[model samples]
Target: MSAAVERARAMIGVPFRLHGRSRAGLDCVGLAALALGREAPGDYGLRSGDVARAEGWLRAAGLRPVAQGRPGDLALARPGPLQLHLMIGTGAGFVHAHAGLGRVVEMPGVSPWPILGWWAVE
Candidate 1:
């Protein structure tokens, strides 16, 4: 598998923790930033609950929207009209920190959200 996919998959089962950005625990943004590596900014965590704000933050951090994506790309979606979530593409799937499950996990299908877009770390 791609290195990004490997890394993201490796993080599976990590407990979810709001505002967390490390192995101890992580939220969706933390998983995305961790999987994206140094291309992500130092303060990449977001708890704003605003899709527009989260998208803006990713843009400000040097990520750019892409027509399509591959493993290692970033994905954003609106789980709720006002709530944005982040995930890392894993080639055939995606990996993310899920609040409901209270951990990171890999999902092997299209997400339930209305995808806002995909972004490349750049």
Candidate 2:
């Protein structure tokens, strides 16, 4: 497993807080940034702005889209073109902050959410 995925696994059970970005609490994007060790753009709520922000960071990291996610890969969940959520791949599953669950967790599958795309971190 990648160091990034190990880092992300360390975050399981962290409380979910919208727009938050700390061990105390974090949103999905915050979790991604934590996992990937990247500085994500400022917080935005339910908009294409979030997607753009994530894309910018991923591009800056030189991440490339992949058909299948590997351990520590980034999985973007998009219910629409605009709204996006980020998760860290664990190979067996994924880890992400869930607002509804009010915590970060490791799910059993490639993704618990619909994948818009999977990006492999170089």
Candidate 3:
């Protein structure tokens, strides 16, 4: 498996904290950043309505838009109105810090939310 996917999976069960950025806790963005070995953004909200900003962040981390997602790719998903969530693909499923679940988790099969885009590390 890809190193990014392995990193994300290794983070499973970490507590979820809004705007968190470390092993002590993590938000979706934080989890993505850690798995991809990029610096996490310090300022961000629980929900984001700006699609361009999210894409920009991915690009800044050396990721590019992909037509299809694969293991280690980042998945941008919309779980609710004005809410953008990020997850790491694991080929079989996805790994992410779930706010409602209060921790990072591995979700098998199809995503529970609608995926807006896919970003692959360069």
Report the number of the highest-TM-score candidate: 3
Which stretches of model 2 miss by more than 4 angstroms? 43-46, 49-53, 79-82
Q: How many clashing residue pairs appear in each of the predictions shown?
A: 0, 0, 0
Q: lDDT score, residue 15, model 2? A: 94
Model 1, 1-122: lDDT tens digits are 66767778889999999877889998887777777774444554344456666677888877899988788888887787557788888777789999999999999888887777899877
Query: lDDT values of the candidates?
Result: 0.79, 0.80, 0.90
The best candidate by lDDT is 3
Candidate 3: Cα lDDT at 57: 72
lDDT of each residue in 46-70, candidate 2, tens digit only: 4563766666667776787888887
* Predicted candidate 3 versus true structure: per-residue lDDT over 5-118, tens digit per residue: 999999999999988888899999999999998887666543756788878777878899999999999999999989999999999999999988999999999998999999
Name the weakest run of 10 consecutive residues (lDDT summed) in model 3. Answer: 40-49
Query: Rank order by lDDT, top first?
Result: 3, 2, 1
Span of ten consecutive residues with least summed lDDT in model 2: 43-52
Per-candidate TM vs. native?
0.86, 0.83, 0.94
Q: Which stretches of candidate 1 lie over 4 Å from their true place?
A: 39-49
Error of 1 at 24 (Å): 0.8
